[model samples]
Target chain A: MQELMGLYTKKEVYKRFDEMNLMELLTNSLKVQMKHIHIENNQTLLSVNDNKKVYFILKGIVAAQKDDELLYFRGKNHFIGLESILFNEESELTMTSIGRVEVIEFSKAEIVEFLMGLQEGWLYCYLISKDLNHLLVRNYFNFQAKPYERSKIMLNDLAKEFGESSDEHVLLPKKFTLAILTNYLGISYVTMRKILETLRNENFIVRSDKQKEICIHTKLF
Target chain B: MQELMGLYTKKEVYKRFDEMNLMELLTNSLKVQMKHIHIENNQTLLSVNDNKKVYFILKGIVAAQKDDELLYFRGKNHFIGLESILFNEESELTMTSIGRVEVIEFSKAEIVEFLMGLQEGWLYCYLISKDLNHLLVRNYFNFQAKPYERSKIMLNDLAKEFGESSDEHVLLPKKFTLAILTNYLGISYVTMRKILETLRNENFIVRSDKQKEICIHTKLF
Candidate 1:
């Protein structure tokens, strides 16, 4: 995967195959195929134990969960259903759409056949890039930290990445709900709520009704 | 990387290149090289900020650290120094040998050039397999669990995976030092020590002098 990085970006790798018009050439000669799928917001794309299907996300965010627990989220350019494909086991996590999601769906047999047809090494590059991206995000948090410390770090990161900033404060977007934010921090809802309450008491954060938007006080930091 | 899984194991992928005698064919014709190195235990293989070099572990374990904190351990068949190669940034973690180690070292330029010569997808498959293996081990623990709960779960998992079992107890290997075990659990040393003390007092675990090997009392579970 590291070697692939010095060669091409994931998108570029995918395009190299398309640019060759290998799709038309292969489909006409070989029988490899992919299907386009459109999923609505909150729709479950794949449930636990689902197998042999891999979704290449073209648009929108996908939430991965283990039963009731939210594991993480993947957005554009990420592939869902990899666990089942990689481990040759049942899907351990269920994946659902955050908004409307469009994907190119490939069955296990078709993907293997497609790679065989290419023999060009680009598909392998694309897969490694996707896995590297997944690892980067999952490795961002310090799992050893206490809940309060973890929450603070997560909030600071969110503010820097997604918040709208001014001199006094940075406003977190409405999309990052309490559930999503808390889960992303790998903390319980109650713990995160208490942490947020403490931050508010300390004049560090200002929250809107229903806790949709949060204003992180910058001066305090 | 998930896609690569249904294709070949990392070792199998590597062997595909060698078995083809592509090395002799290419080195004689195109000029590419890989170096083999032996590292002694506790010796630093790569320091923070070192770039462009990747190590393919042929034997023994390598410990990755961020300063004094143990980040994770990678053993045989894993690649060390991928972060620098993938991100095009300085290495974030320092890698050191845990035991006498053997590795095939490849410079970034040499590796990329070699892959280009092969025109085969096996190298890409190998890279993805490595990343997938890394992600699997890192994702094993529930980061949100309390330290006590986390330690218990980790201990149970360790016993199942690496411990020597008897009717009454399970003995953790001598290689699992307090530092290594606590760090792998992603808990503070003090917290892990306190947890162990409680377990011992409750007759759930027995420890030898200097805490070399821990015997988990099976009947308690």
Candidate 2:
């Protein structure tokens, strides 16, 4: 521990760890112990049966797929690889970086060991539970929502995670095109465009600029 | 523990601890710790926000609902109250007895302490994960499938869970009516009847009797 601390302290690193989205779930000690890793764009960060590592995204996007099926379009602030780690089974899912990404890695053994420290470490369980709730509920809504409903749900999800609240409306985090929105909803671009047209007509959403930022006007679901 | 064991020894009051569902996931000591309860028809077995007990169904059917939405129509050999207990959050979903139901219940604290034992108790996590996977995937399939596809997917689900295998064909566990099938898939009975007619014409499924024991003629999916 001393050697690692010394190695990090020589202007190489120090205790003022940068605040991270998902890492806030960890205690300060656990925070410093987590190792950082970078994955290149389009790289296969984790593949089928490679379950030794578990991490949380600190920046950028990663897509989780099982065979040809897309499981999640995971992004920063999400606990990636959590499902597999919880069970100790080698993952059958493949995770690939959509772009250059940063993540904080934790060894599978260390995580289990930490979780096992039960009463003293119950927060870990709560943190994992929180992630499970979000991921599973989002997936459920995806299964239940119609194209128009899906558009609203996805927009709300994006806004909740990345957007800014204003006096009149909530603004989207970034410019999103028909293609991107359609992909998120697992629908066709034409259908998504039509849905957006309907939403605009109904005043559920409005395009903020040429850059495509969206302002949500009404709760559709 | 000894007193409880003696109390049960006067009569043979247990299954041979058969190779049934949730029991396989429990440690032996925990298995002995479970207490049995019977729920009457139309009874509220576990209401929303009641997170005190976790149970495994031994017989009969239970319906889990979140207000007007049906979450699951659970039958025997399934663990109930799993999600809430894993998160230690009170369940918002209400579980009601569809018929006379038998269950083996365990105290929440005991289960958590048992799980805190780790390695030996990790099976509980796996059990929970398997359930989560089933539910999330089912919800996803629900979102993706059309009425016809949803019907087929649901039938496949029933067959996988309750069907009996024979060389000639797979036999459904129970005689299900068009109403029941339609309700499970969230479609109209008329549409479901039409789907069944088409299935019979295509030889994908054949009804065994007026009671409606469906036989799978081919790989439907």
Candidate 3:
């Protein structure tokens, strides 16, 4: 129990889980199982037809994609695949590990049991509902805006969220290519490329050669 | 208590509320104080800046609008002013009663106490989250489609969900004006009017003089 508590504390969701009385359920139905898997660049971690499994990222980053377009990235302390289980629907997006990774998996049955047993299962549902709604709202806003406006807003929001103060750069993995950016922003590839080029020329983004990744330039902020 | 129970039973939300143990909370915290007020056509039921009070519609229909665009309509057995109370933010939309109406009101403080004391407070939050998320998702889908496509899809969905079976003509509220339809479909008025004309010419919809509202002229199913 102590070891489990320590492991959970290391994961930030533990605090929220405890507040929602999820910890007790987890303790009752929790099983800790770990597996190490090597995923080559772009290898899929989850697929549309795959059985729903909760994943805790132990190492490396995983990106969610739909039709080769990156939805978002999940890294340490973040989880994915809860949506399918909650809605009893097949996975709508694919998850691919960017590199070799280790993760712990929880089955849908276990999760359902835990949720059913919790005194505050609705809190979990509420949190998930809010997240899904926020995602939908973001998508709606992106779709309603023109390509240029969408790109500007996306970059601005990313910069605000993940940009470092010292460097004024937001570091995102190289796995998030132009295709992914276009899909996430609900824009076309050509438009995304043109916007990127324009931003780069205007000193809003700086590209690094070694990493083959781009960062928002300080002026963009 | 008897009067409150009668009102609760009349509202369909009570069924779900009871399943989640919310009825006990409401019955314990609330007393039935009936008030009669009349809303002239298109008059505001709850304005954007009005104090956050929970209102249950006893009669008539109320429509929600934001930025002068109609979003949705609520008839009997529905609660209003929840968004503001839940988020502690000002109402982003104006709610207007379509006709003369009556409603039961409870202050935010009273409602908050009722929720806080319940085991199902989290469930209430979850339900609200789900409702908001569904609305956002619908808006996203509306944005994703082209103007004409969006109108078609929305009309189809409304027909599926709310269309009534009839011998002569299928009836829907005339309140669904071009502006409201366009806003719900996330399209421009020009586009919506074009689609409506197309549907009208094709006999997919029939305008009635008696009700003077929109009705399905053809069996879409």
Candidate 4:
């Protein structure tokens, strides 16, 4: 993590920061107001602080959510709390560091002011404006199918994202516990288990010990 | 909708158009590229023409997303396809004009150019950059609850937003059919119905004709 920090100026907010100038302005704004923070592995990112400000991950990994029905993982160059700041509401997500980590924190007031001012980082302001507008629009879609189709699509997405090619099939990343999968998909554990079991029986997924992760071979939908 | 348009200018992106120079630059770029497009109510915003681009709504209403659990409504000043444009992915949501609508449309190439050439519209370019960063960060931590709790919270949110103020507690808006509610909550119709029935029996909600809509007299959760 320290090595990664040494690789560049602290003003670079993301790996692709140079890909666009708007990104540079955004990081610069955050840099001007940011408070450096650190947390131990498995510690809640907000464990010590309860003020609900946004944090930018300068280094290390974090896992967030169990509310949307699955655990989502994030790492370097990512940020937290735009939703709350954009909407003027509290963040609906909680985060825990995957390891010892470093971050730059910003008060909600500062971030909003930065956007409201729309001066130096106005480009970023436009994007987030577009994003919040999109988010409000997206909240209406992403789940129009029957649970069967919905869960199947999610499985496919997961497979593409986290599945590794193996001799027999694709192996899922280790952390997808049945509890997390069921919750993320918004299905009861029993129901999701039964669904997966049926898929296994049909040879869409490989039957294996529940203690281990899942591997998939075919479309279960 | 026309009344709402009369309340604002064509250049204001959010209510804060005049707030920053970057917003001005961002809007200027879009303004130069924007083509005035109109669609009648229920008309396809993109059902026929399939090139995906971000559109800023200037008048009337539109509802986007066909595959998600519920219908999302957008009105004048709202925009669509930002998620797709920013992420460089196909928009999974479908859209239709709600009544009659007018929009400012910009092609993907133009928007991308606008973002990349930050030296020109540095302000807008900056805003989108920040928004994407915020979005990537936000995806990690929006949920941290059991599925049951999460769904209930969504219900409370719906009631709070759409429910009307009547003497008999707040009545839900007319649009929340069980179909919409069940889909929005991502619960099976039978399960959601049973859950609501149980709430009714417990006096958290009033028994009502399922044919029309649902109303709540107490905390439904």
Which sections of candidate 3 miss by over 4 Å? A1-52, A57-76, A81-103, A115-121, A158-166, A197-214, A218-221, B1-51, B57-76, B81-102, B115-121, B159-165, B168-172, B200-214
**Residue pairs in collision within model 1:** A1-B127
CAPRI verdict (incorrect, acceptable, medium, high) for model 4? incorrect
Candidates ranked, most accurate by lDDT first: 1, 2, 3, 4
Give me the displacement of residue A198 in model 2, in angstroms: 1.9
**Candidate No. with top lDDT:** 1
Q: What's the i-RMS of each model?
A: 6.3, 11.1, 10.0, 12.9
Rank all candidate structures by their TM-score, best first, as comma-separated numbers: 2, 1, 3, 4
Question: Model 1, range B45-156, lDDT digits (tens) per residue?
Answer: 8885565677777777787666555655666665666443334345556788876889877675565555555545344434444454445433433555667876776687
Residues A57-91 of candidate 1 have per-residue lDDT tens digits of: 77767876664556556666656665433333455
Q: lDDT by residue for model 2 over A1-221, one digit each (tens)?
A: 22333445422321222224225645454523587899887778777667777778888777766554555667766666666544355566678776678988877656655545543243344345445555755655444445677677777776666556776677764534454455557678778768777777777776545435577753432
Residue B58: error of model 4 in Å? 9.2
Candidates 1 and 4 compared by lDDT, better number = 1
RMSD of each: 6.3, 9.5, 7.8, 9.7
TM-score of each model, paired residue for residue: 0.68, 0.73, 0.68, 0.56
Which candidate has the highest DockQ of all? 3
Candidate 4 all-Cα RMSD = 9.7
Tens-digit per-residue lDDT, A1-221, candidate 4: 22323465434533223223433555676434767888787667642234357777777666655333334555555565543433334444567765577877777566666655543333343444454444433322334344565566667766755577766678776656676676656567778877887767877778777635678874432
Which regions of candidate 1 are displaced past 4 Å?
A1-42, A56-60, A82-91, A99-116, A119-140, A156-175, A198-210, A215-221, B1-41, B56-60, B82-91, B99-140, B156-176, B198-210, B215-221
By DockQ thresholds, what CAPRI class is model 3?
A: acceptable
- Chain B only, TM-score of each candidate: 0.62, 0.72, 0.72, 0.51
